[model samples]
Target: MPATFIRRIASPKKAVTGLAVAAATAGMALTAAPAHAATTSSAADAKAIAKQMIPDSAQYNAFSKIVQHESGWDVDATNPSSGAYGLVQALPGSKMASAGSDWKTNAKTQIEWGLNYMNDRYGSPAGAWDFWQANGWY
Candidate 1:
Protein backbone atom coordinates (compact mmCIF):
# COMPACT_ATOMS: atom_id res chain seq x y z
CA MET A 1 0.00 0.00 0.00
CA PRO A 2 1.13 3.56 -0.79
CA ALA A 3 0.78 6.41 1.67
CA THR A 4 -0.38 9.85 0.48
CA PHE A 5 0.84 13.11 1.90
CA ILE A 6 -1.69 15.81 2.77
CA ARG A 7 -1.18 19.48 2.01
CA ARG A 8 -2.58 22.34 4.03
CA ILE A 9 -3.68 25.75 2.78
CA ALA A 10 -3.99 28.97 4.70
CA SER A 11 -7.51 30.08 5.58
CA PRO A 12 -8.95 33.02 3.62
CA LYS A 13 -8.84 35.24 6.69
CA LYS A 14 -5.17 34.40 7.30
CA ALA A 15 -4.30 34.92 3.66
CA VAL A 16 -6.04 38.28 3.52
CA THR A 17 -4.45 39.34 6.78
CA GLY A 18 -1.02 38.47 5.46
CA LEU A 19 -1.66 40.45 2.30
CA ALA A 20 -2.91 43.42 4.31
CA VAL A 21 0.21 43.33 6.45
CA ALA A 22 2.43 43.23 3.41
CA ALA A 23 0.57 46.13 1.82
CA ALA A 24 0.79 48.13 5.02
CA THR A 25 4.49 47.43 5.28
CA ALA A 26 4.85 48.82 1.77
CA GLY A 27 2.95 52.01 2.75
CA MET A 28 -0.08 51.25 0.61
CA ALA A 29 -3.64 51.15 1.87
CA LEU A 30 -5.96 48.58 0.34
CA THR A 31 -9.54 49.62 -0.14
CA ALA A 32 -12.52 48.68 -2.28
CA ALA A 33 -15.84 50.41 -2.96
CA PRO A 34 -19.08 48.51 -2.87
CA ALA A 35 -19.79 46.87 -6.24
CA HIS A 36 -23.12 48.67 -6.39
CA ALA A 37 -21.59 52.10 -5.99
CA ALA A 38 -22.27 54.74 -8.63
CA THR A 39 -22.16 53.14 -12.07
CA THR A 40 -22.39 55.40 -15.12
CA SER A 41 -22.80 52.82 -17.86
CA SER A 42 -24.04 49.31 -18.58
CA ALA A 43 -22.05 46.33 -19.76
CA ALA A 44 -23.45 46.73 -23.24
CA ASP A 45 -22.29 50.33 -23.40
CA ALA A 46 -18.86 49.40 -22.15
CA LYS A 47 -18.60 46.66 -24.76
CA ALA A 48 -19.52 49.13 -27.47
CA ILE A 49 -16.88 51.53 -26.23
CA ALA A 50 -14.30 48.78 -26.15
CA LYS A 51 -15.12 47.78 -29.72
CA GLN A 52 -14.63 51.34 -30.86
CA MET A 53 -11.42 51.75 -28.90
CA ILE A 54 -9.97 48.51 -30.25
CA PRO A 55 -10.66 48.68 -33.96
CA ASP A 56 -8.78 45.56 -34.90
CA SER A 57 -11.11 42.56 -34.68
CA ALA A 58 -8.54 40.06 -33.41
CA GLN A 59 -7.12 42.42 -30.83
CA TYR A 60 -10.58 43.51 -29.75
CA ASN A 61 -11.69 39.92 -29.32
CA ALA A 62 -8.67 39.13 -27.18
CA PHE A 63 -9.23 42.22 -25.05
CA SER A 64 -12.94 41.36 -24.81
CA LYS A 65 -12.17 37.86 -23.57
CA ILE A 66 -10.01 39.17 -20.76
CA VAL A 67 -12.57 41.79 -19.72
CA GLN A 68 -15.39 39.25 -19.80
CA HIS A 69 -13.47 36.95 -17.50
CA GLU A 70 -12.25 39.71 -15.19
CA SER A 71 -15.24 42.01 -14.76
CA GLY A 72 -17.91 41.05 -17.29
CA TRP A 73 -17.67 44.58 -18.79
CA ASP A 74 -18.89 46.27 -15.65
CA VAL A 75 -17.59 49.84 -15.51
CA ASP A 76 -17.61 49.83 -11.72
CA ALA A 77 -16.87 46.17 -11.11
CA THR A 78 -15.22 45.35 -7.82
CA ASN A 79 -13.61 42.10 -6.76
CA PRO A 80 -14.74 41.55 -3.19
CA SER A 81 -11.89 39.12 -2.61
CA SER A 82 -8.96 41.16 -3.95
CA GLY A 83 -10.26 44.73 -4.14
CA ALA A 84 -9.56 44.83 -7.86
CA TYR A 85 -11.86 47.34 -9.51
CA GLY A 86 -13.14 48.71 -12.83
CA LEU A 87 -13.36 47.04 -16.23
CA VAL A 88 -9.72 45.94 -16.18
CA GLN A 89 -9.63 44.93 -12.55
CA ALA A 90 -6.74 47.25 -11.70
CA LEU A 91 -5.46 46.03 -8.32
CA PRO A 92 -5.81 49.46 -6.73
CA GLY A 93 -8.45 50.86 -9.03
CA SER A 94 -6.95 54.27 -8.30
CA LYS A 95 -4.22 53.34 -10.73
CA MET A 96 -6.76 53.96 -13.45
CA ALA A 97 -6.85 57.61 -12.41
CA SER A 98 -3.67 58.00 -14.40
CA ALA A 99 -5.82 57.53 -17.48
CA GLY A 100 -8.53 59.93 -16.42
CA SER A 101 -10.19 61.49 -13.37
CA ASP A 102 -13.43 59.69 -14.19
CA TRP A 103 -11.87 56.29 -13.59
CA LYS A 104 -14.49 55.26 -11.06
CA THR A 105 -17.58 55.81 -13.17
CA ASN A 106 -16.37 55.96 -16.76
CA ALA A 107 -15.96 52.92 -18.95
CA LYS A 108 -13.89 54.85 -21.49
CA THR A 109 -11.31 55.78 -18.91
CA GLN A 110 -11.04 52.24 -17.59
CA ILE A 111 -10.67 50.88 -21.08
CA GLU A 112 -7.99 53.41 -21.87
CA TRP A 113 -6.05 52.51 -18.79
CA GLY A 114 -6.50 48.80 -19.44
CA LEU A 115 -5.31 49.19 -23.01
CA ASN A 116 -2.21 51.03 -21.90
CA TYR A 117 -1.49 48.42 -19.26
CA MET A 118 -1.83 45.60 -21.78
CA ASN A 119 0.41 47.39 -24.23
CA ASP A 120 3.03 48.28 -21.69
CA ARG A 121 3.11 44.94 -19.87
CA TYR A 122 2.57 42.41 -22.65
CA GLY A 123 3.11 44.24 -25.94
CA SER A 124 -0.53 43.98 -27.02
CA PRO A 125 -3.99 42.88 -26.03
CA ALA A 126 -3.48 39.56 -27.83
CA GLY A 127 -0.32 38.96 -25.86
CA ALA A 128 -2.13 39.82 -22.65
CA TRP A 129 -4.86 37.41 -23.65
CA ASP A 130 -2.32 34.62 -24.15
CA PHE A 131 -0.88 35.25 -20.69
CA TRP A 132 -4.35 35.46 -19.17
CA GLN A 133 -5.38 32.18 -20.80
CA ALA A 134 -2.35 30.38 -19.38
CA ASN A 135 -2.47 31.95 -15.92
CA GLY A 136 -6.16 32.84 -15.54
CA TRP A 137 -5.12 36.45 -15.15
CA TYR A 138 -3.17 39.29 -16.81
Candidate 2:
Protein backbone atom coordinates (compact mmCIF):
# COMPACT_ATOMS: atom_id res chain seq x y z
CA MET A 1 0.00 0.00 0.00
CA PRO A 2 1.17 3.55 -0.64
CA ALA A 3 2.21 5.70 2.33
CA THR A 4 -0.78 7.20 4.05
CA PHE A 5 -0.80 10.38 6.22
CA ILE A 6 -3.76 11.60 8.31
CA ARG A 7 -3.78 15.18 9.58
CA ARG A 8 -5.99 16.04 12.58
CA ILE A 9 -8.68 18.52 11.82
CA ALA A 10 -9.67 21.37 14.12
CA SER A 11 -11.77 20.53 17.18
CA PRO A 12 -15.56 20.57 16.66
CA LYS A 13 -16.05 21.86 20.23
CA LYS A 14 -14.05 25.00 19.47
CA ALA A 15 -16.24 25.79 16.43
CA VAL A 16 -19.35 25.27 18.52
CA THR A 17 -18.04 27.53 21.28
CA GLY A 18 -17.33 30.32 18.79
CA LEU A 19 -20.82 30.11 17.36
CA ALA A 20 -22.31 30.15 20.86
CA VAL A 21 -20.44 33.34 21.70
CA ALA A 22 -21.62 34.98 18.49
CA ALA A 23 -25.21 33.98 19.16
CA ALA A 24 -25.04 35.38 22.71
CA THR A 25 -23.60 38.67 21.46
CA ALA A 26 -26.35 38.96 18.83
CA GLY A 27 -29.00 38.28 21.45
CA MET A 28 -27.59 40.96 23.72
CA ALA A 29 -27.61 43.44 20.86
CA LEU A 30 -31.27 42.67 20.18
CA THR A 31 -32.11 43.31 23.83
CA ALA A 32 -30.41 46.69 23.64
CA ALA A 33 -32.46 47.74 20.60
CA PRO A 34 -35.78 47.22 22.38
CA ALA A 35 -34.70 49.37 25.35
CA HIS A 36 -33.78 52.22 23.00
CA ALA A 37 -37.02 51.87 21.05
CA ALA A 38 -39.04 51.80 24.26
CA THR A 39 -37.55 55.10 25.44
CA THR A 40 -38.39 56.81 22.13
CA SER A 41 -41.88 55.34 22.00
CA SER A 42 -42.51 56.34 25.60
CA ALA A 43 -41.73 59.95 24.74
CA ALA A 44 -44.14 59.84 21.79
CA ASP A 45 -46.80 58.20 23.91
CA ALA A 46 -46.40 60.84 26.61
CA LYS A 47 -46.74 63.67 24.07
CA ALA A 48 -49.84 62.06 22.57
CA ILE A 49 -51.40 61.66 25.99
CA ALA A 50 -50.64 65.25 26.87
CA LYS A 51 -52.26 66.46 23.65
CA GLN A 52 -55.31 64.32 24.26
CA MET A 53 -55.72 65.59 27.80
CA ILE A 54 -55.38 69.25 26.84
CA PRO A 55 -58.68 69.68 25.02
CA ASP A 56 -57.85 73.25 24.08
CA SER A 57 -55.42 73.62 21.18
CA ALA A 58 -54.00 76.86 22.53
CA GLN A 59 -53.34 75.31 25.93
CA TYR A 60 -51.58 72.34 24.32
CA ASN A 61 -49.38 74.68 22.34
CA ALA A 62 -48.56 76.63 25.45
CA PHE A 63 -47.75 73.46 27.34
CA SER A 64 -45.50 72.36 24.53
CA LYS A 65 -43.61 75.64 24.68
CA ILE A 66 -42.95 75.32 28.39
CA VAL A 67 -41.86 71.70 28.11
CA GLN A 68 -39.53 72.55 25.23
CA HIS A 69 -37.70 75.06 27.35
CA GLU A 70 -37.72 73.11 30.60
CA SER A 71 -36.58 69.69 29.52
CA GLY A 72 -37.02 69.53 25.78
CA TRP A 73 -39.83 67.03 26.40
CA ASP A 74 -37.40 64.58 27.93
CA VAL A 75 -38.99 62.61 30.75
CA ASP A 76 -35.60 61.69 32.21
CA ALA A 77 -34.13 65.17 32.31
CA THR A 78 -32.73 66.29 35.64
CA ASN A 79 -31.43 69.65 36.82
CA PRO A 80 -28.26 68.90 38.74
CA SER A 81 -28.36 71.97 40.94
CA SER A 82 -32.06 71.90 41.78
CA GLY A 83 -32.71 68.14 41.54
CA ALA A 84 -35.72 68.92 39.34
CA TYR A 85 -36.70 66.14 36.99
CA GLY A 86 -38.89 64.96 34.08
CA LEU A 87 -40.58 66.90 31.26
CA VAL A 88 -41.66 69.80 33.46
CA GLN A 89 -38.64 69.67 35.77
CA ALA A 90 -40.50 69.38 39.07
CA LEU A 91 -38.14 70.40 41.84
CA PRO A 92 -37.28 67.57 44.27
CA GLY A 93 -38.70 65.15 41.67
CA SER A 94 -40.32 63.10 44.42
CA LYS A 95 -43.44 65.24 44.12
CA MET A 96 -44.34 63.24 41.02
CA ALA A 97 -44.94 60.19 43.21
CA SER A 98 -48.48 61.47 43.62
CA ALA A 99 -49.10 60.95 39.90
CA GLY A 100 -47.82 57.37 39.83
CA SER A 101 -45.10 55.10 41.10
CA ASP A 102 -43.59 54.91 37.63
CA TRP A 103 -43.02 58.66 37.44
CA LYS A 104 -39.28 58.14 37.22
CA THR A 105 -39.54 55.92 34.14
CA ASN A 106 -42.95 56.66 32.64
CA ALA A 107 -43.33 59.75 30.44
CA LYS A 108 -47.11 59.59 30.60
CA THR A 109 -46.98 59.89 34.37
CA GLN A 110 -44.61 62.82 34.09
CA ILE A 111 -46.87 64.58 31.62
CA GLU A 112 -49.90 64.09 33.83
CA TRP A 113 -48.07 65.46 36.81
CA GLY A 114 -46.74 68.37 34.77
CA LEU A 115 -50.20 69.30 33.52
CA ASN A 116 -51.57 69.21 37.01
CA TYR A 117 -48.73 71.37 38.26
CA MET A 118 -49.32 73.91 35.53
CA ASN A 119 -53.02 74.02 36.16
CA ASP A 120 -52.68 74.29 39.91
CA ARG A 121 -49.80 76.74 40.05
CA TYR A 122 -50.47 79.03 37.11
CA GLY A 123 -54.20 78.44 36.60
CA SER A 124 -53.43 77.01 33.15
CA PRO A 125 -50.61 76.15 30.74
CA ALA A 126 -50.97 79.48 28.94
CA GLY A 127 -50.64 81.27 32.23
CA ALA A 128 -47.52 79.27 32.98
CA TRP A 129 -46.06 80.12 29.58
CA ASP A 130 -46.69 83.79 30.14
CA PHE A 131 -44.90 83.59 33.46
CA TRP A 132 -42.03 81.63 31.90
CA GLN A 133 -41.62 84.16 29.08
CA ALA A 134 -41.47 87.04 31.50
CA ASN A 135 -39.27 85.40 34.14
CA GLY A 136 -37.36 82.67 32.26
CA TRP A 137 -38.57 80.08 34.77
CA TYR A 138 -42.10 78.93 35.61
**Candidate closest to the true structure, highest TM-score:** 1
* Residue-wise C-alpha lDDT for candidate 1, range 5-49, written one tens digit per residue: 222337987766766776787788989755543445689889888
lDDT of 2: 0.81
True-structure RMSD for candidate 2:
10.2
Model 2 residue 45 lDDT score: 70
Q: For residues 1-138, could you state the per-residue lDDT of candidate 2 as single tens digits?
A: 112322333897775565556667657322323342234345567678788888899999999899989988788889988999988999889899899877887777778898899999999999999999999999
Task: Name the best candidate (by lDDT).
Answer: 1
Quickly count the clashes in candidate 2. 0
Candidate lDDT (C-alpha), each: 0.88, 0.81
Alpha carbon deviation, residue 100, candidate 1 (Å): 0.5
